[model samples]
Target: MVNVGIGLAVGALLLFGGWVVTAGLATRSVSAVNAVFLSYVASLGIIGIYVLLARRPITGTQTDLVFALLSGVFLAIGTVSFYGALTRGDMAIVSAIAALYFIVPVVVDVVYFETNLGATNLLGLGLAVVAVVLITV
Candidate 1:
């Protein structure tokens, strides 16, 4: 059977990739902060609607809430910075560097979560680095 989780993740990847390109293009006409603020507002409104339609309960433990708050803060900071970079720098270079952020999670998973990467995974990671380098230069 096809893995629904993997399929959804691929869908998310495509969606986010498109979002990056769209944001890069759209932010060209506005200040980075203004663009990011509007982006988040639109996202919040859309997600809020989805939650309401799905009757999704927004409930969590105290720790979960705290983590969620931190996540939001970090996301806002990163998004604003990314938009700023996109507006000020060549989009290809900015995006190549931005894509390297994936390394952080991989490191965290390997170190703290004791997760292991297969040979293929490691090869893919190396290839991604090479791809970014090629893109930037």
Candidate 2:
């Protein structure tokens, strides 16, 4: 319970901080591309420093390394595009649309991974689609 709570708290803090920074920069006339770069680099530096200070070994197996690299590349593309949209559109609407990107992985799980998505999961997916439509239109 303590571990789950810590995870939830940390994840929320990270997400909230990311959104505030992105929106604040976008509203302050910073170009979306630059904002993405700034945020990415700053995050890398801050986290890297922390890991170093903690005397932790920065280690990953080969498969983990590949996945980590791919994750960073994929995230950079998405974050850059999202920040770009934020610069030109209402944050509320843009974020709602961008948030729907999570559906991709959900779909991949069902299609590619053959994961069993129960009725509740299917309904959740339907609701997510409805949400995107509501926000977009």
Candidate 3:
């Protein structure tokens, strides 16, 4: 359990670091579309190297590959959209608004996966939504 918690914390830190680098690159780039495309290509290269070095065999079904591809597509769209939003809107406002996406996955997990949304979780989710609303308004 301790290792799992540490792993999660490290993962979160890495994610934020990635986001910071991507956002800075997007801001500096002349074109958001190109930035997003190049970012994805860079990510693919890193992941490919990791897979090769780790010797993780790819055994996923076609459906799994399709879903993974779709996820990449969605990520590309999101990256472009976020960069565009940041260019047109205040950075703080755009980031706060984008944070609302947290609600979508939480709701989906609760509804589709029948995950247990305990009282504390529900309260936290509600507070997050409220914060987004307040920040935007």
RMSD of each: 1.8, 2.6, 2.6
Q: Which tens-of-lDDT digit does each residue in 1-137 have in candidate 2?
A: 56998999899979976775566566568887788878878889999999989998758898998999999899899887877777778777777777777789888888999999899988998998898888888
Clashing pairs in 1: none
Show how many residue pairs clash in every candidate, following the order shown.
Answer: 0, 0, 0
What value does the lDDT take at residue 100 in candidate 2?
Answer: 77
Tens digit of per-residue lDDT, candidate 1, span 1-137: 87999999999999988888988888879899998988899999999999989997879999999999999999999999999999999987998889899999999999999999999989989999999999988
Minimum summed lDDT over a 10-residue window in model 3 is located at 20-29
For model 2, the superposed segments whose C-alpha errors exceed 4 Å read 1-14, 17-21, 24-28
Top model number, lDDT: 1
lDDT of 3 by residue, 24-56 (tens): 557764576676677678889999999999997
The runs of at least 3 residues in candidate 3 whose Cα sits more than 4 Å from the true structure, single-residue gaps closed, are 21-25
